[model samples]
Target chain A: MRRFLKLVAIEWKLTNREFITIFFTLIFPILMLLLFGTMYGNEASEFMGGYGSVDVSTPGYINMIIAVTGIMSLPLTLAQYRERKILKRFMATPTKPIEILLSQFIVNILLTILGLVLLIVVGKIVFDLHFFGNFFEAIFTFFIILLSIFSIGLLIAGVSKNAKMATAIAYIVYFPMLFLSGATMPLQMMPQSIVNISKALPMTYGVTLFKGIWLGDHLIDYPLEIIILFSITLVFGGLAVKFFKWE
Target chain B: MNVIEVKNLIKKYKNFTAVDHISLEVEEGCIFGMLGPNGAGKTTTIECIIGLKNRDGGEVNVLGIDPNVDYKKLYNLIGVQLQETSYQDKIKVYEICELFTSMYENPVDYHILLDRFGLHDKAKSYLSQLSGGQRQKIAIILALISNPKLVFLDELTTGLDPKSRREMWDYIKELKNEGRTVFMTTHYMEEAAYLCDKICIINDGKIIALDTVDGVIDLADIDQVISFETEEDIVQLIEKEIKGINKIEKENKKLKIYSKREDLLTDLVIFLKEKSIKYRKIDINRPGLEDAFIKLTEKTRKVE
Candidate 1:
């Protein structure tokens, strides 16, 4: 346990030393939130109309967009670590693979929370938007969404041989989730075929669970969403752990 | 007792044997050297012994523990310095030392190690900023921090200049004084001659010679060469009349006589005087480790 901690500490220190990585990982997501939030303010109405029949003013759609954006940022952070060989060096030590993966999980979770806070803060201070329901429920749902998305990111990083390939794979996996999860376009407006396909995506379940709390509507019960999200987390997380290549 | 024992160790990569049926033993508290040229399977053997590579056949025991089954226990007892010591560019020397030391239960003091390597002032410097020799010193320090019972050093002084090479030799001697067993592989014959109590010369993934330094040198039956600049064709006379002379060659006004008897030198002097053939200069050269290495490897090649 002590050895694992030492490895984690060393990895953390090395990660911090890369000034550019810190800027992109921790600060760049906040920058993106501010830039995108400002550009789409009130204009989210026009963009919603092109998707066909959904109302732009729905609070659920707005909240899903904010939450899915935060989840997509997880992959960029992990790909940076893989590019630098920090994972390979740690594996050569006495540190177990599980501990190394856990440390990355903890770091990604903290960053996701930071990104969430930035989006919320920007949403309230700039756009005068407010979340609809119990604060604790919203926070707990957000946690599950972030965890599930990050596990997918972990799987991508573990399987990729290099950063360039990882970036390409992350984008290929992320764009469909963002576009189809009722984040940018309401699921009610999308064709039934697309909805049926998106239902298999973990992000779709996340967006549904998140939207439930955002609009205070019991569209899907919280317990069922939690169970589905947890299952997705376990399966992807196990595959990531099983196939992870330290080098 | 032997600290390391291997029997018929074999490693094959898709029908190509990298390490073939090699066997050797390293006694406790001795500087054992694995002398070989490049692509001689030295690194493969070391990796297999350390459990970094799997062996197709044979048994390996380090400190009475099987590395394949008990690597965790073996890891705690042995330290290794590979040819390349990789690290993050921004990590400072002291941080690396501390981090590697923390992996073991009982570790030597980091500061003291830095001082001993004359790297105390560079403790705060990053790895990218250090010289090659300094980086190598840091690697050695990291290897010894655990104060392991057995240490493996691969090409430990390959690129160092002469002065730094001598310093590293002294450091290895210090480790010997502290009762540590070191298994090292090197291409430098002089380094082996200076430090190794026992050496196994490996060629083509097999042990060609294994013995004390002097014993290996003595195994070659060829005698030394005595060369001199002479005005006469003394090579012809020496080849015909010298009783113990094995071979004689002459080129560019110089004569070389190879003899098995030591008294051949005295006889040659008397023979030259009788012929009134005064030589400009003469020198007698004895066979050294390099000569034995060439002879053994050449003989092995011929037998194959």
Candidate 2:
């Protein structure tokens, strides 16, 4: 436990020095919230599929923030560690390889929570955005979504040959989720075909669930989204653990 | 006591064997070297002994524990310095040191280790900010920080400049003086000659020769190199007259005679005097590890 905590602490210290990850995970989401908040004001504007801009889009952008944390931050760091044989170095010690993976999970989870808080605080202060419904449920739903997305990221991290390949994989998964999965734009505004495609995306389920909870939809109301999120988490998370490469 | 014992260790990758039934023992507190060319399975053997890779066949005992059975138990007793291990680029030296220190149940004072390796001043410097030699020093310090009874150093001085290499050699000797069992692998014959108490020459995934430093050199058969620059061309004359000339080569106006005979030096001088050959510089050079490695590997290659 001590070794695991120490690894988590070291991982945080190391990650804090990365400017790009900081920009995308923490700064970028807040910037998106501010941009949309300015353009669509506090009133329930029809610009966001009849929902107010700050009301629904801010939560969606917050989903994008967690997506960056999962898809980009997790895989890139793991791949870099593997590429540089940092994982192999730990294999020589008593510290098992799983400990490193767990530590990375802990560190990224903390960062995502911190980013979520900052996004909420910033939106409330500057844009008059309010969480109309259960805040605690939103946090719970965010964790489930994080688990699903991070498992997919871990799969990429496990299979990539190097850091460059991991980055390419991350971007390939990220851009689609960001633009089409209701993370950046509203799914209701899209054509039926794009909505159908969005329906197939895990991020779509994540955004819809978070948006529901932010606007006061109870957790028991969305059975399908909950099933999909938990299912993806179990499947990809298992594969990630089974196929994880230390070298 | 043997700190490490490997018997007929076989590591196969699909169809090819990386380590082919190789066996050796490293005695306690001795600097043992595994000397081989690339792809000779030196690294594979070390990895297996350290429990990083699994072996297909045979036994590996480190600190009286089978590494494959309980490598975690051996972790505190054995330390390994891999050829190209690295930390996160943004991590500071001291931070990495502390991280590794926390991994061990009982760690040596990293401050003293860092100062000894001349990295105390660079403790706050990030990994990317340090020079290659400094990074290598930190790697060594990290390996030793756990105070392991046995240490494995692979290609320890491969890319360093002469000064840094010499400094590393001195530090390795210091480790020996501190009573640590050191097992190292290197392609540099000079490094093996200077540091290794016993050398195992591996060729084509097998042990071709194992002996003390001088023993291996002596076993190479060509024991002495007699070279002289003659005003008169006597290459052909000496080749015809010298009874036990093992090999001979001529460059420009100088000639070298390599012989395994015990009295080749005396016999050569007598021949020179009798032939009235005016030799300017006559010197006898003892054969070293390089000559032995080439000869041993060549012999093994022929058998294969």
TM-score of each: 0.79, 0.96
Q: Which stretches in model 1 have alpha-carbon errors above 4 Å?
A: A42-94, A101-105, A111-129, A133-247, B220-223, B259-266, B294-304
For model 2 chain B, the run of ten residues with the poorest summed lDDT: B217-226
**DockQ metric, candidate 2:** 0.86
Question: What are the DockQ scores of the candidates, in order?
Answer: 0.30, 0.86
Give the least accurate 10-residue stretch of model 1 chain B, judged by summed lDDT.
B80-89
The digit string of per-residue lDDT tens for model 1 on B113-210 reads 89998999999899879988887788788888877888889999999999889989998988888899999998888899999999899888999889
Question: lDDT by residue for model 2 over A100-152, one digit each (tens)?
Answer: 88888888889888888888899889978878779689879989999999999
Standalone chain B TM-score for every prediction: 0.94, 0.93
Maximum-DockQ candidate? 2
